[model samples]
Target: MIYIACGAILLALGLIWLIKPAKKANPLYGYSSYLAQVNQGSFAFAQKKASLYFALFGLLQLLLGVGIHLLKWDRYFLIWLLTFYFFILFPIVATEKSLKQFLIKRHELPADYVDPDKVKHEKTKGFRDRK
Candidate 1:
């Protein structure tokens, strides 16, 4: 019951983040690691990547919960407790590791490097014209 509730909450939050990620590096919401908050590009990339990981983990957790319930493994409270903790912490660790790798790769590019996709997006949306 607890596992199912936690899983559902995580899945819902993941979907929400996926559908409407934070547009900027504000401390109020979204993935706010130092590397992710370093720049708009990093924040966007982290949000997308984090959402995918979260969604995937949440689904896994939901399935595990269902399996445990069906298998009558809930009696082993300690094991399930550890498993729950793992599921809770692993996603954040994985997201941060990926974000670090992304920032490293981005830094490897030339100082004047411009992301073509970002340029195309801005051009299409006219983001540069706004105040």
Candidate 2:
């Protein structure tokens, strides 16, 4: 029962993140990690990737919970508890690793390389319009 509830909550959150991710790097919402918060590109990529991973993991958790319940695995509560924790934490780790790979790829660009997205964003707002 607990696993089902937790899985549902995770799935809901993941869906929300996917539907409307935070546009800016704010501490209050979205996948705000040091690497993710480094730039708008990383932040956006992290949010999208994290949402997918989370949703996938959440669905897996829900199925696992159902299986455990059907098989009467209540006797091995500790094992199930650890599995729950793994499902919760594994997505974050996977997202971070993928984010690192993304950053590394971006860094491979030439020194004079300019991100068109950043340029467009800057052009839309004045210097004092910083958020």
Candidate 3:
């Protein structure tokens, strides 16, 4: 019963995102990745990618959850947790990786863009180098 409920909630959230993904980066709302926050364009792209992948994976999770409950596999709680973890992580990682590749391919990322995650104090040039 609880498993089914959780699955339903996940499905609902995914549907909501599919209907209307967050447009901008906000601490309270959209996907707040540093790569996504680079600019409005990146923000929009990241949000769309994240929401799309999330909805897809979320649906998978819902089905898996239901299957678990139906099979009376309550002892496999760890499997459920692992599935949920991947469900949450897949979209975020995919979005960031996609955004990074897009920026690099287009050569649009700012020269001074400091990747705090990659480096400690290395300096960069600027933000959103349109050129």
Candidate 4:
């Protein structure tokens, strides 16, 4: 039970740590720098890559957290708290962080942008659930 909780903490941190967003010199920088050069007009490529990883990482973290709770390892009250924290607080944090980053990058785009294939321009309003 405790092992699961510990694993949740470690997994969450591990996924977050997987993102390399710094300017530190390393092998990854060579590839990312090349990507930046290819996308010299904007930071879209870098941000897109980062956002993809963010979503994937968050999904994995959420899944692992849910799996832990489903095992019913409620041997102590502390486990319940940790479970609640991971299922509730952790998701909120992850979603909020992801949304903030998405918005930030999106807002930086050209104001004249348009996607003709998008349904947003249609009269139909899509359902959106609030987090």
User: Using TM-score as the measure, which candidate wins?
Assistant: 2
**Per-residue CA lDDT of candidate 2, range 1-131, in tens?**
65776787778878999999988877887888877876788889999998988888888888878887999987788877766888889889889888877988888323454543467544445457765
- Name the lDDT of candidate 2: 0.80
What is the C-alpha lDDT profile of model 4 across 1-131, one tens digit per residue? 44445445544544543464434324543123332333333334444444444445445555655666587544554755555444334433444344444545756433444423453543445686433
Clashes of each: 0, 0, 2, 0
- Better by TM-score, candidate 4 or 1: 1
Candidate lDDT (C-alpha), each: 0.77, 0.80, 0.70, 0.45
From the highest lDDT down, the ranking of the candidates is: 2, 1, 3, 4
Name every residue pair that clashes in candidate 4: none
| lDDT of candidate 1 at residue 91, scale 0 to 100 | 75
TM-score preference between candidates 2 and 3, better one: 2
Off by over 4 Å in 2: 108-131
Tell me each candidate's TM-score. 0.76, 0.77, 0.70, 0.29
- Candidate 3 displacement at residue 98 in angstroms: 1.4
lDDT by residue (tens digit), candidate 1, 1-131: 56776787778778889999999876776777766777888889889988888888888888889998999988887877766867777778888778777877877423555543467533445445754
List per-candidate RMSD values in Å.
Answer: 14.0, 12.1, 7.6, 11.1
